[model samples]
Target: MSVAATRRLNLVTEPILPRIRPAIAALAPYKQGKQAGPDAFKLSSNENPFEPLPSVLEALQRTAPINRYPDATASRLRARLGVRYGVNVEQVHVASGSVSILQQLILATAAAGDEVIYAWRSFEAYPSLPLVAGATGVQVPLTADARHDLNAMADAVTDNTRAIILCTPNNPTGPIITSAEFTAFVERVPADVLVILDEAYAEFVTVPDAVDGLAERVYEKHPNVVVLRTFSKAYGLAGLRVGYAIGHEKVLDSARTTGIPLSVTSAAENAGIASLDAEAELLERVAVIVERRTRLLEGLRAAGWDVPDSQANFVWLPTGERTDEIAAAFVANDLVVRPFSGDGIRISVGEEASIDRVISVATSVR
Candidate 1:
């Protein structure tokens, strides 16, 4: 086309483009977990280092035709989870991952003027989901020790608040909210505001007083409560990408209505079933992780790294401004750990061998 024709076309298009939704333009894309090299020790993303249980492996080997579509309702897996959790099948919904369910939950319940409440520096996805849903994000700052301040979180709730997400044994930080505190918080929260109890790391936590708020008790009494769990962590099925939400039928129905893609793959469903069946075996691996987490913390403390008492499968090194130096040193030693802020590096507790290598690198860096 001639220069004048092209100029006129551009002028017309520019005005039309400005009419696009402001929310879409202002939104930030979700940043995914860090990647690790083949030869490096990857402690990013808080994944279980354990191989899939033999049963899960066998199930995958027996994989059916991938050419066919998956069960949109995911009936068999839902049935098994219902029986396991003692909830009606209608109360449970499965998704490719807990993150997908979280996104669906946000979209279903919140609108442009509504709000989604969560802790800062918690799950990286927490803030992004609200922006995508065109909802305001109320991020309460973490307490000095890096735990969620439930009181402040509850106080932040306003008439516009539609949902609150709580990540127990919080990622990056590792402190868990007690049952009593959560119970009190819930009682104060408005009945209509949905509280999402994200228990993705629950299976790894072994505290006697540790709040397993996602247990059947909460769901039974609180119609507004929803618990999210995943096979990605303790079940060691991260590659399979299966997670589920347990809540009242009404709440689940709203989330399901958002239309999760039907083809979640039959392989993921089979893997989940196999993992659930191998619970005892998976727990054994979890025990090892717990032990490693303890030893790793003790080691870091002895080396004067000021580590927190982490219940998750990873330990955080709060080095403040030295975070970059520390993380760079690990990379120099051919190790990979997730770094956050200028002071924190989350190192996953892997196999005994990998743990030793990480410890050595940390010691050298220090």
Candidate 2:
């Protein structure tokens, strides 16, 4: 064959893969909080500073049957959560983490040509969750005070919108949606749309009027609402990866269809059960973190930093244009914080000793 003919044959023989979805190709992988070095504290992930209770550890140790797959439905844990939340077992859906449940809910409700609305600068994972499910993300800007502008978010809703995520004590920003505001917003949203209330940091909240998500049986009244919670924060089970959602049985049934079967291991389930069993002890630790957060906020404000009133375990430093520079200064001082360049920094309340260093760095930057 001629040279051109041979080249054509080679081209035909070469393997050519189908094009990847442009949305997936353009997506950035989730960036985890940076880890700290040997002498430094890792205040980036907003992890609970306290260790697991002895009962939790004991339950983890007692987990058996490594050779067998875990319960696909996490029945016992779900039942316990149902009892605690005053919902039926069918209303509880447990997953690897609240994030996983969020993803499942997105997949269950949204797809290409659909829109999932959420506040900008809320959870880092919120934007990406819809993308993975081939849904468009519509982000509403937060208020000047770093709180969700629920009214604006409601206004942004269109016929194509399928889901709305409301993250209370919103991650990185640390402001909770008030009960009255949330109820009013819920009323405005179309009943056909799914509203996910992410309460990952619920246990740390000291605000009396903050939307409880479950305390008022809002979910009971609104079949479209779902509340997501995690053991990772208050219960110190970040390593185990267990979270749950309370919603209408039909809605949870849809999410359950999207979940990865048996992804929640026996150990995680047992630990979660044990954590609930030791709730009082775990909450005492939450009290300590809350106290630290209060002091941290006071220090930041006194140092001339206009920080938001944080109901979560972390505080947001609105460094704006100086975000990168301020974050670097903290890193240099062995403090690892999550920085959204051109926006601000999120410093998790960590070890008691780490607070002094965090305050010093904030003071210097100011």
Using lDDT, give the best candidate's number.
2
What digit string (tens of lDDT, one per residue) describes model 1 on residues 195-313?
A: 99998888878787777855645977888999999888888888888889999899999888885677456888998898888888889999999999988888887777777778888
Where is model 1 poorest over a 10-residue stretch in terms of lDDT?
14-23
Error at 361, model 2, angstroms: 0.8
Highest TM-score: which candidate?
Answer: 2
For candidate 2, the lDDT comes to 0.94
Candidate 1 displacement at residue 166 in angstroms: 0.2
lDDT of each: 0.85, 0.94
lDDT of 2 by residue, 86-203 (tens): 8899999999999999999999999999999999999999889889999999999999999999999999999999999999998889999999999999999999999999999999
Query: Could you tell me how far off, in angstroms, the CA of residue 290 lies in candidate 1 after the best superposition?
Result: 1.2
Position 186, candidate 2: lDDT: 95
